[model samples]
Target: MDKQTMLSDEELVKNFIAGNVTCIDVLIDRHKAKVFSYIMMCVKQQELAEDIFQEAFIRVIKTLKKGRYSDSGKFSSWVMRIAHNLIIDHYRKQKNQVMVSNDNYEFDLFNSARFSDKSVEEKLVHDQILSEVGMLVKMLPDNQREVVEMRHYKGLSFKEIAEETNVSINTALGRMRYALMNLRRMMEERNLSLTLS
Candidate 1:
């Protein structure tokens, strides 16, 4: 087995709990880059991926501080679970991303795979469609706009958003629902069916 596999996770946790915060640093150093890489795959933005990476660790520390997690299996799983949820939340919010100009559209701007697969004509047409949808999203109400921006751009959850905005999670969820409904109506009006995912 490798070095990490050789050390029992309990041993590491015990070290971390016994006032060796640097032991947790070792864990962070090992996992942070990989976790960010995974986030980038889903969120498709370097800055947003970095933000989510930091948030994931902050949540991890909170869980540890709460003394809620015992098994290392649960710890690792929990981290990935948080990352997964953040990515999903990001898509939901970005569904109606805004467009300030053609250059500000969100389509395949970050898709590395598309560059290799798409021709210039295809890319240009794709950018046009993205710009149109982004314009539609920009026309949504202010509260819905902010919620979507936080969800998509900042990768914050409904609960995290509620905490940030000093509102209830239900309010956050309601805003998201209305935002999606409005975006759908806008798309239908233009005969465009954009897939949020």
Candidate 2:
């Protein structure tokens, strides 16, 4: 488990399957940062991101123990798949309400060099678009909102989300349907059209 000893992903997987708990720790050390950052970027909430990070690794460990993964070099990809699923579950549980946690986040989705050179009027227009989108999300019904957030923010596949949320994949799809519809209605109410052409 020494940091100086770099192990290949396949080696780590083999050691982990052989009951070397230290291998799991080493794997976490190697991938935790990237996975955490990736989830954070998607979720935009620190507490939820942390929970999903822990859940992702826990699932990975369980899967390794189960000996279910069928290939190599795909360890990172598999872990990402777990992370995505957990995020969906997290939001599904929080659909109707907000979660209280100590983690805080500051994300600037609109701050970029592309915006830096824009005129003040253009910046205002960009800000308005972001504001409208935020408002639309806030107005979605509890269940629909959850589905949309999980799919868009967490990057979960419908099947993975269905597993995590304990719903049929069709149900997950229905919730997403309602979510988009409600968001569109809300936008239209505010004289903003968000239709995709």
Candidate 3:
């Protein structure tokens, strides 16, 4: 349990891939509220949302365990996309005339901005993963890490990053690319899961 406590989101995912079902619980416990709220926005019924939430995660598990997981985008985004699609499938199957404006649901469902009260345990676990990810960021090369911090933490654009770093826009972009590459590689080496905030 101590060892598991140190694992990152990608690491937990690796555990899930390695056949530890409990890892899935870690994932659900982390994202359940955000995902559930996203579902409720669509279905507007707690029971239906819960059902789709389970179905979405089941599909996530199958995709990961079956060696079909691909890195098309952020992991949280991918899972939310899966859940969104299932919601669509559900409504289609029932032939229900659902008319909900999707403007609110266009972004990642697990967006940290959508906040609710959290339990003490969830808060601690979130802080732990966030802290570890912070350490990983510090582990990056000077050039790459600088860009990552500027972009993610400062919410700067490529131009802004370049301006702040006194580099050309292309250089800024390149640094970001390399930073992401190295970050992904580092997480893979440590078997870290990219935790959602």
Candidate 4:
């Protein structure tokens, strides 16, 4: 077995930053599939996914070369985040070209299945529900709304949310709990059915 193949991602990153160019290749080879798959899953387009995947690595290389990467032993997670952000930026740009009639902007919060896999009727229903839910989320209190957006829309973990919001994990979880309850209450009051008959 190659020694480089056995090195941890963090170790590979350190080696890469310390002038070992091949270490970056090993890191990319190890994580390319997972990172590319995530981008494909989110964007659902081959060309776009490839572009985002490349851009992610470019950003990763730039960050590492600039000594901006912290040694958190989470190099893969950090890479995935960069890819995710690129995907979000792509969608955000696309969204600006099209307008939806609603108080709140649309968000592709659900990551269950590929949108392209759905039938036309199913896709329409799914989009309607997503828009409705997005509006409901907009109506939540500021803190709860922030939590919901970060947790659901951004696909952030509770720990990440806590850190980003400068709160404890327990507090982040509590906000998510209350946000769900409030969304449920609002849905019930509006007699909204998320299901398609």
| Model 3: residues with Cα > 4 Å off, grouped in runs | 96-197
Clashing pairs in 3: 8-193, 9-193, 10-192, 10-193, 10-194, 11-191, 11-192, 11-193
lDDT measured at residue 167 in model 2 versus the true structure, 0 to 100? 93
TM-score of each: 0.44, 0.47, 0.45, 0.52
- The lDDT values for all models are 0.74, 0.78, 0.81, 0.88
When superposed on Cα atoms, how far off is each prediction in RMSD?
Answer: 15.9, 16.9, 19.6, 14.2
Residue lDDT tens for model 3, 120-197: 877888888888789989999999999998776644578988888899999999988998888789899999876655
**Please, what are the lDDT tens digits per residue for candidate 4 over residues 44-151?**
677888899999999999999999998875889999999999988998999898554544646554434653368899989999999999999999999999999877
Ranking by TM-score: 4, 2, 3, 1
lDDT of 1 by residue, 1-197 (tens): 24543455466566677666666776776667567767876778778888887888887777776777667465566788888887887777776583234465677555566345667777777787788767876999988988887787556778989998888999999998999999989889889855422
Residue 148 CA error for candidate 1 (Å)? Answer: 34
Error of 4 at 133 (Å): 27
Model 2, 1-197: lDDT tens digits are 56424887778888879887788887788888679878898788778788889888877888889998667557788888889888788788787575334345365544566545667776777777777787788777777777777787666678988887889999999999888777777766768854322
Badly placed stretches (over 4 Å) of model 4 are: 100-197
Residue 41's lDDT within candidate 3 is 71
User: How well does candidate 4 score on lDDT at residue 50?
Assistant: 88
Candidate 4: pairs in clash: none
By lDDT, the best candidate is: 4
